[model samples]
Structures are given as structure tokens and as C-alpha cells.
Target: MKSNRYIMILFFIVTLLNSSCSDTFVDDIDLKFCGKCAHTGRWTVDSLDFNPCFSTQAECLDWAKKNGYSDRGCVLCN
Candidate 1:
């Protein structure tokens, strides 16, 4: 009986640990919420090779200037 109780306790602890280690969120919020105001990888803004970077006009401009890029316009909604 004592051994059975210890086994049950171990099982409970293992279950709890497994559940806590999961990367999945417990809430129902949309994944988009993580990047709501952030850049969405749309619009290239320069002569430089671009990747998904800024989420705002200002950010794009700053990036262009820092990298010596000469173009500053929206590419496509990424």
C-alpha cells in the first residue's frame, strides 16, 4: 500500500512537470497578438538586400539610412 501511494505521487509529479514544460500557451489569445504593432515582413525599403524587419515607416527609414540604402518605398504586404 505504501509503495502504491509512492507510485501515485510520482505519477502526479511527472504529469505536472510535463504539463508545465510545454511551450503551448494556456490562454486562447491569437498568435498575431504577439506581433500586433510590430512589422509584418512587408515592403522592402532600399537598394540593400532586405528581410522582414521593421513594422513601421520610421523603422524602415532608419534601417535604410543606417545601411546606406537609397530607396524608401513599400514593397509588398508581408
Candidate 2:
């Protein structure tokens, strides 16, 4: 009986660890640009606008350049 209890506990622990390690958010990794922002002053996963709209930092910077926001890049909104 003790062995069975131990096995159950082990199974529960394994299941918990697996769930914790799994990615629960978006599958595709999204990046955000924070040019000249106080947050990071660069590209990052976290955004002040809470908008992770670009797939790559280059794309985000491109948008910024095209939209006349090269100096203070705009956050790509979703």
C-alpha cells in the first residue's frame, strides 16, 4: 500500500512538472520593439504598450522607419 501511494505521488509530481514546463502561451514567438523607451531602449519580449506585434525585431524597426517613427518607434498594435 505504501509503495502504491509512493507511485501515485511520483506520478503526480511528474505530471505537475510536465505541465509547468509546457508553453501555455502563444506557439509562435512574438517580439516587440521599444526604441528609445524607458523600459529597455531596445527590442524585447515585454512592451510598455503591451503589444507584441512583430514576429522579428527587424520587422518592427522596418515598420518604425516607414511610419516616420524611426526616432521614437511606435509599438505595433495588434
Candidate 3:
């Protein structure tokens, strides 16, 4: 019946949408603008590590220090 075909089409569309909506991990991503920035760090659950190659390293460091900052990988400046 036509209803069966419509149901199949709807199911297919829903399947495609769900597949496209999957979340991605941040480490798998790269950028052209911030590739050279030092503030582009990623976080672990317990600590912050420096990512010197990222253009946003300074920003990331600040964010970590203010928000989630820990001394796990920090080098003392003082």
C-alpha cells in the first residue's frame, strides 16, 4: 500500500538525520586560522596541558586557569 511506502521513506529520512547528528570528538578536528596559535589546547578531566601549536593557546590557557585550571602540566613562571 501507499502508506507502507510512505512509512519506509519516513524511516529512511529519520535514519539519515540521526546519523548526521552524531557528535564528534574535538581532537579529531583541525583549523586553518588557529593552526599556529598557542592557546588552542584541549582538556583532560583533571588537568590542562599546553598546546603550543594552536593559535588560541593563550586563550585556552587563560580559560583553563580561570575556569578549569590545574597545575598538572603548568611550569612555574615565578
Candidate 4:
């Protein structure tokens, strides 16, 4: 029916609006990175330790290096 078609169109418009708004909002928020350290012989998740979140990847990497960890990297958190 014409009514059903109109309802579907309205729903589509609302969905588009919501998705666009949410995308912009998410882009405005800063992403956090955490430092991950592991042993040279161990690459498993269980062998890695996660450090506190940093505002930038460089900071996370620097923290790992300063802590005397041989294997270190940064990972996105949250």
C-alpha cells in the first residue's frame, strides 16, 4: 500500500540520519592506545601484559621501551 511505502521511506531516512550523526560523534572522540609487552620466546596472549592507556601510539611504545621489555607494541584499547 502507499502508506506502507511512505513508512518505509521515513524509516530509511531516520536510519540514515542516525548513522551519519553517530559516525561524526565517534570521530570526535580520541582513540586510546595501550602498551603490550611479551617475552621473546612467547607470543601468546597469556604471556603479554597490557599497560595503561596512552593518548598516542608513540607514548605507549615509549613506555614499553622504558620498562626494559624486549618485545613491545601498542594496541588500541576500548
The TM-scores, one per candidate, come to 0.33, 0.29, 0.30, 0.35
lDDT of 4 by residue, 7-41 (tens): 99999999998877876788898543323432322
Task: Give the runs in model 3 whose Cα sits over 4 Å from its true position.
Answer: 25-78
Model 1 stretches with alpha carbons more than 4 Å out? 1-43, 46-48, 76-78
Tens-digit lDDT track of model 3 for 12-74: 999998887655744556433333332435322223333333223454466556654545333
Off by over 4 Å in 4: 1-47
- Candidate 1 weakest lDDT stretch, 10 residues: 29-38
For residues 1-78, write the lDDT of model 1, one tens digit per residue.
999999999999999999887555546433332132234554445333434455676776676667666454534344
Error of 2 at 53 (Å): 37
TM-score of 2: 0.29
For each candidate, the alpha-carbon lDDT, in order, equals 0.56, 0.57, 0.47, 0.56
- Over 1-78, each residue of candidate 2 has an lDDT whose tens digit, in order, gives 999999999999999988877574545556554434435444423334433356557876776567555675544333
Q: What is the lDDT for 63 in model 3?
A: 52
lDDT of 3 at 72: 32
Kindly report the root-mean-square deviation of model 3 from the true structure over all alpha carbons. 9.6
Candidate 3 accuracy as TM-score: 0.30
lDDT: worst 10-residue window of model 4: 38-47
